[model samples]
Target: MNYLVCVLLIGVGATAVMDLWAIARKRLFGIPSLDYGLVGRWFAYLARGRFRHDAIATTPPIRGERLIGWTLHYLIGIAFATILLGIWGLTWVRHPTIWPALIVGIGTVAAPFLVMQPGMGAGIAASRTPRPAVARLQSLITHGIFGLGLYAAGWMTSFFYTP
Candidate 1:
């Protein structure tokens, strides 16, 4: 299989797994998942030359914000997959290891902690939230789960692609 095809499959599959975890988390723990619509809104504002928001939830809704956010979410996943491939090369893709995938997945939390949260006005690492510790833990767990998803997806990809 083409390398690009492998990347796309692994990325999409991993993201889907993460989405499944979000649903399970919400249903099992009565905890809500990140609202990707807000992500879309943030991106929309960024496109308009605005970077920070006092509270993205209060921000005016933009047309197609949900679609934009969902699209960006998957694209970000794909980008991360690219990063993994870039670092590890095709040899890793052929072998599909867990540590590298987990490292990249967990490392992704920095994006939200430094950029997305601050831009959305949640404060760094959700310090501004009512339950900062819980939020942080949740973020860590979710990202870890995403890492597992990456590993799982990598295995799935390896099954179909020898190279």
Candidate 2:
């Protein structure tokens, strides 16, 4: 239905905004953007019955992993957007306020902290990283930016929905 399409569009748009922030962060602060290829490698191993890695970056690279990782990144974004819509309902989408979107966007950090990082061997919330505090802060900031992106996307969506 139209609602479904709207959710997908908002999700994709918000995620794109997040990515743009990453690029800007890298350019302005000398921070490196995440190499989603590791994500792909981890996921590729899922097919072979491997669920965890001591160090995903050291794991053998999977063929087409770059493609897979990038694709998964967007898919996960879409999933998060779907979660937002499910929790807030279509009425929220029609009105498109920033607070709900921001909360959902910030809340999504759990997936990376609890699920993705641990699975990739970075430890829960990047505990095993060389600089755990820095890693955690970076994650928080990135997710916060994602929250802003969600708000921006929601505003755009509202603009389109208005009569």
Candidate 3:
């Protein structure tokens, strides 16, 4: 397996795992999943010279926003996988350690806390939400789950692309 192919598979697989967790959480805990449509709306606004919003949920619906958001979600996963592989190299990919994956996965929370949430008007780390602590906790847990996904995906990828 090519390095890029391995990375893509690992990333997509990990992201799928995260999505599954979201669905399960929603069903079992009655927690709402992050609305990717808002993500799509954010991207759509980029073309219109807008980058931030006070409340992305209030923003007008954009055409194909769902598609755009879902695509970006997977692409972002791939990008993160690239970052992981870049730092850890092929050795880590072959070995599939847990620490690096968890570190990278948890570190990803910064993107939402500092960038996404602020851009979507959820305040930093979801402080603007009605339940700030709960939101923050959810984000942490979700990212941790993503970290686990990364580890799982890495292990799976190693089966096909052994060092």
Top candidate on TM-score is 1
Superposed model 3: Cα runs more than 4 Å off: none
Worst 10 residues of 3 by lDDT: 154-163
lDDT of 3 by residue, 37-104 (tens): 88999989988998789899889999999999999989988888888899998888788999999999
Q: Estimate each model's TM-score.
A: 0.97, 0.95, 0.97
The regions of model 1 sitting more than 4 angstroms off are: none
lDDT of 2: 0.87
TM-score of 3: 0.97
Candidate 2 lDDT tens digits, 12-108: 8888988998999999999999999999999999999998899998999999999999999988888888988888877876788888888988899
Pairs that clash in candidate 1: none
Instruction: Write one digit per residue (lDDT tens) for candidate 1, span 1-163.
Output: 8879878988898889899999998999998998999999999999899999999999999999999999999998888888888899778778999999999999999988999999999999999999999989999988888888888998988888864
**Candidate 1: worst-modelled 10 consecutive residues by lDDT:** 154-163
How many Å off is the CA of 93 in candidate 2? 1.8
- In candidate 3, which residue pairs clash? none
